[model samples]
Target chain A: MSLDAPTDHTGLRVMGAEECLERLASVPVGRIAFTGNGKVAILPVHHVVKGVDVCFRTSGGSKIEAAADHASVGFEVDSYDPSTRSGWSVTVSGIATVVDDDGLVVELEASDPTPWTMGDRSREVWIRIRTDELSGRELTRT
Target chain B: MSLDAPTDHTGLRVMGAEECLERLASVPVGRIAFTGNGKVAILPVHHVVKGVDVCFRTSGGSKIEAAADHASVGFEVDSYDPSTRSGWSVTVSGIATVVDDDGLVVELEASDPTPWTMGDRSREVWIRIRTDELSGRELTRT
Candidate 1:
């Protein structure tokens, strides 16, 4: 069950799909990338893994609103250790859509993945990225 | 001169342009997001802040290659502390293009911000993203 493995010559290894999904579910934060108003945009977001999908709450904004309308979006999360120069990065690309189901929204809120910053970021809208394509890479010193 | 500031009621503050630039230059790694071949893509990339522009090296690949052809791209770097629930995120959006200047390519490679994955990723092609718009936000707990 250990995700760690002996490093090879290149010190880099492609992570398996299961490991990628495990890492995605374990991380509470990631960056969501989407094209908004004809511009590429990336924003740090607090997220929760629901099954195989990634969901995050947002107060209405041009970027998140645009992502809801866009056909495709990118999500990335990583853990790196500077001292050891080791870590892994996981990226998921999929369709992003608004989660309008009332019951599900309430259920998600119970997980407490809301924005860490204290403010009126009530996050009325919830967006979920369905995992169409998932990939990851890990690096470690031998 | 201190990037650190007292946590306000909102627990959030807008960072000044100079401070944003300073943090970006100090970080050696970031995520690059772009729309390539009609798909959203985000990849971890090691970049150097050269003046107001962000530069990185890439070997010929569909994702990075497509980014070079795209008109606009997104770059982001962030640092978060889980225990303190504090962090800052900086994002830059601009046009991306291949750097064909032979002399300049040599100078950039000398900085050694290339891929950490050891391999024959010669990364002869140098890509530069012109920072047309830059923004950042910080979060802290009182």
Candidate 2:
């Protein structure tokens, strides 16, 4: 699609669920959204995909405390190339929970992903989001 | 500070508030976070600054509707240079509200920013965050 095409302010193409998941998995960084203190907080996280869940490590504290039992959360991954003025984004909506299974923790640690925050392991926590409600958008260069 | 120096994981050397605001003003894109249907939803917004309040034009649908009634929101802007493995990020935390003030809108529109999304202005929402709560971090190149 050409970036100079007539703009369609009312038109938004909805992407399929499966496609959104695939694209989201390809990206390494995304923002995690959750409610805290009656307001919305977004934090950047480095994530890895396992099966249909998105998982990331956090160093304890408020983020996990607020989201552990949270019924739903949002995870989004996007990439933009300013030179081309084009990018795509994928958003996944699902419940969040603390991943405590020993086996899963080992696997997650084996991945050795860099944490977004510089902290000791005192706040080690992992959150996974279900993949049922996933959607995406691709912005063409214009 | 040299990149080789060990730094606290969460220890981000603070920049002056005005410096933070100046950096934010130069950036055209940022991520807006809110609670949508009890889940976390984050969308990229093309925003402008009015003093300390961050304002952006949206479609007046999901982003606006979900953020109504003093929603706690986070607006984040960052720039990364992969070759040097260096970057800086600034986050603003505050409530989001729909603004109807014509004079402020006209001043904002006069800036003539190029919209990141292909859409007309169905809604113009302003999110105001406290300047004191704003923080930033810059990574030193090795």
Candidate 3:
């Protein structure tokens, strides 16, 4: 562990896969980063950990369009406390695809992932981010 | 305010530039999204708003490298309350560059932006994100 690698420092701990999922599942709101209109855009969404996949709901907008386009996406949920300088952030990097299958959509909707904007529940599109690249970091006082 | 446009809805309000910056300046920590290694990466960092430029510190790593690479970056600051089902998110979509000028670095450091992981202040590289495409959305009950 070199000094240049801060993750190797005593104050910061690199979280394992299980911890990452736990932190993610604990939060209902997370941000999604995607490339749209030739620029990167990040927006907040409500997500639920359905099995190993992080799922969210989006209506007719860039998010749904990103899903329809199957764009490369990054989903992140984080918590930070400036006074204590302690926090945890989990990021899921993968592709966003729309779930159109009626059976799957019905099942995913059963989980009732709240869309940030909150609109017609039946009109919402289910976007599932399936990825193996799950990483997180926890910060603590040295 | 059409049915297709969710922003014009009764609950969600599109924030102006002034409000966006205010939301950003009020928060000490924000997440940055950038493209590195052919993938979009989002990480949380302590930030300070310097006029139109939002700045943060990073050591010799992917973040600094992203600055060196002059990457297209997106910075987001948000707050959400699930109980009220309300939240506000501000996003800055722009390019990230390194502030290597000694005079400027010293001046920026005078503000004393605490890096997420407390490290040697002098050793950390300052990354400035400049963007005109600032947008935000505030969500409340309908």
Q: Please state every model's RMSD to the true fold in angstroms.
A: 3.6, 3.9, 4.0
Q: What are the clashing pairs of model 1?
A: none
CAPRI class assigned to model 2: medium
Ranking of all predicted structures according to TM-score, beginning with the best and ending with the worst: 3, 1, 2
What DockQ, on C-alphas, does every prediction get?
0.57, 0.53, 0.54
TM-score of 2: 0.81
Name the candidate, 1 or 3, with the larger lDDT value: 1
Each model's chain A TM-score: 0.85, 0.81, 0.84
Candidate 1 Cα errors over 4 Å, as ranges: A1-11, A121-123, B1-11, B113-115, B121-123
lDDT of each: 0.80, 0.69, 0.78
Docking quality tier of model 1: medium
lDDT by residue for model 2 (B104-126), tens: 66776777456666665655454
Question: Backbone clashes per model, in order?
Answer: 0, 7, 0
Q: Which one wins on DockQ? A: 1
TM of chain B vs. native, candidate 3: 0.85
Candidates 1 and 2 compared: the better one by TM-score is: 1
Kindly report which residue stretches of model 3 are placed more than 4 angstroms away from their true locations once superposed. Answer: A1-11, A61-64, A120-122, B1-11, B119-122
lDDT of 1 at B20: 86
Tens digits of per-residue lDDT for model 1 on A107-130? 888877546766556645778898
Best-matching candidate per TM-score:
3
